[model samples]
Target: MTTASPRWFKSSYSGTTSNCVEVAINLVASHGTVPVRDSKVSDGPSFSVSASAFSSFVAGVKGGRLGV
Candidate 1:
């Protein structure tokens, strides 16, 4: 997939620093996995995930379910 098509989004929580990460969402023909990448490296590597896995991740994050 072309890097141009992925829409990168920044977290609402950010600090006053030059260093920050961005998430790119690429929902294409791959129906299950959600592609995520760093904004600094648009052409860099990315991680893939199933839709259910992604949801669980978000839920854990919001609910502090990770036990971190």
Candidate 2:
């Protein structure tokens, strides 16, 4: 079976820097997870976390609970 490829994108608030991460939300429906990877290394390793968990992480970042 062929696997779906991630449509990766970084946050709009992310500046043009090498320190940002890219995420693909496209798999949430099909895979129930969000894939994340380093923007500086597109061909490097990538991993996925549950949708709810990813949402919580984003919320924490926005709420300043993540401390950057």
Local distance difference test scores for all models:
0.65, 0.92
- What is the Å distance of residue 4 in model 2 from its true position? 2.0
Error of 1 at 51 (Å): 1.0
As a whole number from 0 to 100, the lDDT of residue 61 in candidate 1 is 90
Q: In candidate 1, which residue ranges exceed 4 Å CA deviation? A: 1-4, 15-21, 25-30
TM-score, cand. 1 vs. native? 0.64
Q: What is the alpha-carbon lDDT for the whole of candidate 2? A: 0.92
TM-score of every prediction relative to native = 0.64, 0.87
Candidate 1 lDDT over residue span 1-68, tens digit each: 33345566667776554355655455634455566766567677877777678778989999998989
**Residue pairs that clash (backbone atoms under 3 angstroms), model 2:** none
Query: Each candidate: how many clashes?
Result: 0, 0
